[model samples]
Target chain A: MSLLAVGTLAYDDVYTPYGEVKMIEAGSCTYIAMAATYFVQPVQVVSVIGGDYNDDFLADLQRRGSDLEGVEVIPEGKSFYWAGRYHDDMMGRDTLDTQLNVLADFDPKVPESYRKAPYVMLGNLTPAVQSRVLDQLTERPKLVALDTMNFWMDHALEDLMAVLKRIDVLIINDEEARQLSGELSLLKAAAKIVEMGPKILIIKKGEHGALLFEGENLFSAPALLLPKVVDPTGAGDTFAGGLIGYLAATDDLSFANLKRAVIYGSAMASFVVEDFGTRRMQTLDQEQIDRRVQRFGELMTVSL
Target chain B: MSLLAVGTLAYDDVYTPYGEVKMIEAGSCTYIAMAATYFVQPVQVVSVIGGDYNDDFLADLQRRGSDLEGVEVIPEGKSFYWAGRYHDDMMGRDTLDTQLNVLADFDPKVPESYRKAPYVMLGNLTPAVQSRVLDQLTERPKLVALDTMNFWMDHALEDLMAVLKRIDVLIINDEEARQLSGELSLLKAAAKIVEMGPKILIIKKGEHGALLFEGENLFSAPALLLPKVVDPTGAGDTFAGGLIGYLAATDDLSFANLKRAVIYGSAMASFVVEDFGTRRMQTLDQEQIDRRVQRFGELMTVSL
Candidate 1:
């Protein structure tokens, strides 16, 4: 089954205690495409890039089995740019600048071939944009997973809620889950979220791990606890890609399958944070991915 | 194999958004004894109470197979008392009052029966007191686990180090691990701690779960992830009780056994915070514990 991901393709400048990397290729859609390409072939990416986007970066994605036919290039505008610096612990960071040059008027148009993709991932973006993608779909995909942030919930909750009702699963951080559900406890927040829409609710706890709740089935996937965390930027999006990618490749969305997918996502995310932007992810291969997933299985499993 | 626990037995006045539980039965040793009693019978508790300690509370301990003959009742002093209020989220709290009273000069005397117990748990307390218990041991216990707080590390570094050298395992929270190791990364902190003395180090990330590191094995256990957390007080001590108690009951100190014990501890601690101090744990039975452990096994297990 093919997968279609809609988000941004932008430039990011990231700073960590280890040092800084300038003009790093980044964005939610780009991250998803890169991570998913490891498990699934020809991930169709629908995003807008600007004239300034590095051709080499685009070529890299093509080499990794990411189809760029759906990515629109706005020749007159500048690429979206974001700059952030991680704190000492590297779990949290402060955004330095957000230049939404090309992204300011982003109107993602899914190509004809991409619309019928069996799996869809709507990365964090304006609710209107996410809804636009849903509107373009001829039929609901086998699975529609979404990633959203607190910003949209705070400012565009009604639109976000409308988009949420159309998705099969919603992936959000702990704080976003709490804010959306008006619940303090994550478990309560997940239950409330599942009632609102999606059959599955994933609460991402960053360094703590992620929780997947569907009805009464609850599964936890611990973040690969690394001794050094260089950057946390795009880790969440990478996780989403790995999750959906694994599920798409296996053509299984059962609770058990989703649990393993979360582990795979976690493994992919662990590589994303090892270096700035997507440098580490760019070099990761299937062997390394499987090894990390095995490590995650080992770190969390115990026989009675 | 009996388990000997040394710590405080006191009353706590806790207020939370859920409600207030006044004069709730608390204390590290008390919580530990109750949790440990689930897996190991006849847990030996050594600590000082006072004339004010309730008779019914003591009777309840005896009924639960807690050998309290080592409890010294001071006629002139009062039982230790602590008052605290949890914030809305229940993850952090502030101490309102701490009246050492009888615990001001507590000199725990290890009973002759407990002196040779195979398993010994030194609950969080003054490092000097912890050392005294270690000194009283007639023969080295098969396993010695120590729990200490930031207070002792801040005020009694030498004494804390003295005790660290004698313990087989050290149980501490994430913050304490970072503070003690001076490393922001938990993995690095655990590594640094293991070098200090303890062959095993368990970093408790309350509500998030616990991590166990011994030799090359690393095991992570998820917290119960309850829908509601009425109170978080005594959760850590309860977790320690569960961990050591399970190990003592099985008399297995292998790395695999320790991993299972950590899960049991995580399960037991989940009950500790379901309501105010010892309330949930008090009502928990072996069947409930078994069910929770089984769920934990399900939540964490992944076939490779």
Candidate 2:
């Protein structure tokens, strides 16, 4: 089974207490495709970038089985650029720069070959753009998951709520969940958000863990408790990518399978935070991924 | 086998969004003994109270198999009085009043029959008082679990460390774990904390959940997702009580048993938050408690 991802692909400069990096390759689809490759193959990506990007990065994605035919590159324009600094705890960050040169006019074009992929992941982007991708799909994928930020909730509620009604799953951080639902209690927030649209709501609680709420059932996914988190820029997108990819591979949407999917997603995210800007995710082999996932299961088991 | 709990006994005036209760029977030992009685028999308690306390409250404790021979009553003084207001989130509270009354000169006295009890749960109290109870023990108990607060970390670090060395387990909230270890990452904090004394650490994250760490093994317990949390005052102490009480009843301290203990603790803690000042706990029956605990098990399980 194949997975389809649609979002921005760009160059990012990130600062953290541990250190700083300049002009590194990053973006929503970038980390998503990288992490998803560990689970399902032929990750077809639909995103827009500019001529300023490096060729080696494209080669890396393609080499990892990413179908980049839908990745548009405009030679005359600069790529989307973002600069941010992570706080000491790695839970919060301040956006220092965002030059949306090509992304400002980003018009995603889902390739004809990619439109019928079995799984779809809508990475953090404009809700209208997310909606546009759904409009382009020739048939509904087996699973449709959407990830959004506080930006859409603040500026584009109409578009966001409209898109939310069409997706099967919504992946967001704890703070975003609170802001979007206006509920202080997460349990109440999950109930409210599910009422608004998606059948499943996954609230990502950074290092604490993740919670999956579907109907009356819930599953708590454990995050690998690391001694340190170097950079957490793409952890959430990586998690979403890992999740949808696992679902596509297993071809099951049962709550039991989705629980395992969350564990897989958590393992992928744990790798992302260990290094800077997709570096650790890029080098992860299947054995290393399986080992981390096994640990999650061990961390949760109790023989009674 | 018996469970011995040593802590404060007082009257609490609580203000929550749900409502307010004036001079309700409450205390660290009150909730602990109530929760412990659900799992084990002969819950021996050591604490001080005032003559002004209600006789019906004492009758209720004895009705639940609480051996109160060690409880000291001061005829001329008022009971320890506390007033607090829960914040909107229900995760934090502000102390509006604290009249130590008889607790000012509180002296814990462990009874002879309680000295050899197989399980000990020291609810939040002064480090010196916690240590004194340990010193009074005739022989080392099978398991000694100590729960404390940030107040002791700030004022009684030396004594806390001394008691920590003698205990088998330490239970504290996530914030206190960070403060005690001076490590922001919980994984690193657990590594440091285990080195200081106790071999096991349980970091309670109010509504988020709880994490158990013992050497390389770990377990995550999910907090019950309530539609509304009326009060959170004695949830932690109740958790400690449930945990030790289960251990005592089962007479097992293996890793597998400890994992079950935490789940029982989480189940007990969840009940405490549903109402004000031990109201819910006082009314709980065994069947209701077991059903909640079974639900927790189902929530955490992920079939591979």
Candidate 3:
């Protein structure tokens, strides 16, 4: 089965202690599509960008097995651009620039071929935009996983919850989980969110790892224990890519499968933080992916 | 085949949002011995107390299969006393009182029966006291695990490093590890500590979990993902008890065995946080232990 991801495909400027790199290729849809391409045969990406968005960048995504037919090009506007500097901890960041450009008034249109895709990933974006993509889907996808940030939770909470009820899984960072549920305890927050809609809740704790809670069963996947994290800009998106990619490839959404998916996501996220922006993910290959997955298995295993 | 734990046994007054309990039984040695007794047949405890130390308390430790022959009673002084208040997170606490009483000028004397024990747990205490206990051992234990706090690291860096060189395993919290090694990254800190002396290094991350680093192999054991934590006073000591206890019970110090030991320690720590002080460990039985172990296995497993 194929997977379709809906979000921004944009250019980013990232600053880290390692150094500063300008005009780095980034965005939720870009990383998610790249990561998912490893597990699935073909991944479809739907988003809008301006003429300034380079052809080479689009070609790279195509090279990674992503179908770019759904990616719309706006000749007048510029691609979404964001600039941020990560602190030493890599856990916190300060946004230096955000020019929505084409994303300001863009609309997402799921291509006809992608309409039949079995899985859908809603990356972090405006609630209105996310809802628009969902509205365009002819049939409900077998599984819908959504990733959102604090912005949507604060500004578009009602729309966010509306989308939450329609999705099968809701993935968010720990702080957002606490804010959405109005509960300080993550467990309590997850339980409350599950009651609101989604059957599964994945709480991402950044460097600490992620948790998969379905019913009474809870599984934790630790982030790759790196000595130093160069940049953490898109680690969360990379994790989401791994999560939905594994599920789409296996066509299995069982709790056990979801646990493995989280591990894959964590392994992919580890690479994302190894270098600034998408530098590491760009150079990552199947061999490196397998080795990191094995490392995650060994790191997490409990021998009897 | 057996383990000996040396430290204080005292009454603790603790307050938490869940509730408050005055004069609850608590002490690093007491919790450590109790946790160790779960896996090992009998844990020998060595320490001193005053006339005020209750017989019923001593009986409680003995009932858990701890040998109290090494406990010395001081005729005139009072027992050690501690009071603390847990914040909302439960991961940090404020020391409200610390009356050393008989512990002020204590000199631990390892009993003849305990001198030949194969495993020894040096719970948090003065570096000099830890060194004295090491000096008293007739034959070097197969494994010596030392647990220390930031207090000693700040006050007695030389003595602490001296004792660290003589131990087989060193366990300290994440902050202390950073301070001792002057490295912000845990991976770097662990590597630095291994160079200093111990072959095995454990960096505790409180609720997040703990990391065990030996040479190139690293194993992470997550803390029990509980919805609520009543108290966290003795959780670290209980964790140490479980680690050394599991090691002594298995009589294996290989990396594979260390993985299981960390899981056991994590499970024991989970129990400690469920209630105030050592209350939960006190009521825990073999069946509960088995079930928690099974849960941990399931939580970390991935069929890759």
Candidate 4:
């Protein structure tokens, strides 16, 4: 089964208490596509970049099994560039700059070859962009998982809800779930959010872990405890990518499989936060991933 | 194996978003003894209560299998009284009043029979008072676990450290662990805290769950997702009580047993927050306790 991912591709500068980085290869799709490739081959990317985008980076993604047919390059404009500084706690950050040069008038163009992809991951993007990717798809993918942030909830709620109705799963943070559902309790928020759209809700809590809710059934996945969080920039997108990628690989949509997918997602995010940007994410091996996944089981299991 | 608990016994006035309650049975030892009796026999309590303490409450505790021979009556003073208003979150509270009448000058006197209790639980109290109880014991217990809070860390670091060195296990919340260890990351905090004293460290994160760390070994427990948190007043103390109680009942001090104890502790705490103070904690039967403990197993288990 093919997996398609649509989101941003950019150059990011992250400043954190652990350290700082400049001009790292980043963006929602960059992390998503990379993480997705770990479980599924040929992660089809539909994103926009500019002439400033590194050709070597594109080549590297392709070499690692990404289909970049729909990744448009605006030769005259600079690529999307973002700068952020993480607070004392890496849980949050302040966006210093978001220069959406090539992405300003961005139009998601799905290649015909990728239009029939059976799995689609709508990474954090404007609701309109996320919905547009679906509109271009030849058929409704077997599973459509969308990731969004609170900015859209604060600004484009109507648009966000429109996209929600068309997706099967929604992967957002706990805070966003509360804001969108107008409920303080995560259980209530999950219930309210499911009624609005997406039957499956994955509420990510930075270090605490993630919660998976489908109807009355609920599963809590603990985050892999890292010795230190070097950078948290793309941890969430990487989590979503690994989740859908594992689902796409296994082709199992049962609640049990979804639970396994979440564990895999959590394991992948553990690697993402280990190093700045996608440095560690891009270098992961199956053995390393397997060990982390195993650790999650051991960390959570108590024979009682 | 007998389990002993020593700490405050108070009348608490709690106000929350759901509603408010007048002076009810509360305090560290109250919740501890109540939660402890469900897993172990003869939960021995050593504390000081004023004449205002209800005789029926004492009889009720005794009826529920608590040995309150060490609970002294200070007829000249009022019982310890605490008034707090829980914010909407229910995870924390603002202590509006803490009129420590008898407790201000509390000098715990452990009964002769309890001096041989193999399992000892030192609930949140002045480190000086907790040490006094241990110093009065004729024989050393097989396992000694102490639960403390941020207040002690702030006002009596030396005293807190003094007690830490004498305990076999330390059960405290995430915030207190960070404050005590002077480390942010829990992994690092666990390592630093263990070096200072106890070999086993249990870090409790209210709604998130708890972490059991012993040397290089670490286990994560998920909190039972509640429909709504009615009150979180005695949840932590209840958790500690359940942990030591389970440990004492099993009579195994292995890390594996400690891990199971943490889960049982988590299950016991799930009931504590269901209602204000110890209202829910006091009424739990063995069957109800078993079900919640089983639910925690199911909740945390993911067959990978």
Superposed on all Cα atoms, the candidates' RMSDs to the truth, in angstroms, are 1.2, 1.3, 1.9, 1.1
Where does candidate 2 stray beyond 4 Å?
A: none
TM-score for each model: 0.98, 0.98, 0.96, 0.98
Reference-based TM-score, model 3: 0.96
Overlapping backbone residue pairs in candidate 2 total 0
lDDT of 1 by residue, B1-304 (tens): 9999999999999999999988877999999999999999889999999898889988999899899988999987899999999888776899999999999999988888788899999999999999999899999999999999998889999999989999999999999999999999998998899988999999999878889999889988887778788888888999999999999999989988999999999999888888888878778988999999998988876665
* Candidate 2: true contacts recovered, fraction: 0.69
Best by DockQ: 1
Write one digit per residue (lDDT tens) for candidate 2, span A1-304. Answer: 9999998788999999999999999999998999888778899999998888899999999999899999898999999999999888776799999999999988899999998887999999999999999999999887899999998999999999999999999999988999999987888999999998999999999887899999999887777788888999989999998888899888899999999999999999999989999899878899998898889888888764
- Off-target runs (Cα >4 Å) in candidate 1 are none
Which residue pairs overlap in candidate 3's backbone? none
Report the number of clashing residue pairs per model: 0, 0, 0, 0
Candidate 4 at A224: error in angstroms?
A: 1.6
Please give, for residues B192-296, the per-residue lDDT of candidate 4 as tens digits: 999888999999988899899987788999998888888888888999989999999999988899999998888888998888888897678889988888878
Clashes of 4: 0
lDDT of 3 by residue, B1-304 (tens): 8898998899899998899998877889988998999999689898888888878878988888999988899978888999988887665679999999999998988888888888999999998999999898899899999999889878998999899989999988989998999987788888899998999999888877889999999988877778888888888899999999999999989999998998889899989888877878878898998899888888877887
Candidate 3, position A57, lDDT: 78
What residue pairs clash in candidate 2, if any at all?
A: none
Candidate 4 on A156-212: residue-level lDDT in tens? 999999999999999999889989998888988888999988999999998999999
Q: How accurate is candidate 1 locally (lDDT)?
A: 0.91
lDDT of 1 by residue, A79-184 (tens): 9999998888776789999999989999888898888889999999998899999899887899999999999988999999899889999999998998999988
Error of 3 at A192 (Å): 1.8
DockQ of 4: 0.75
lDDT of 3 at A64: 87
Q: Which ten residues in a row have the lowest lDDT in candidate 3 chain B?
A: B84-93
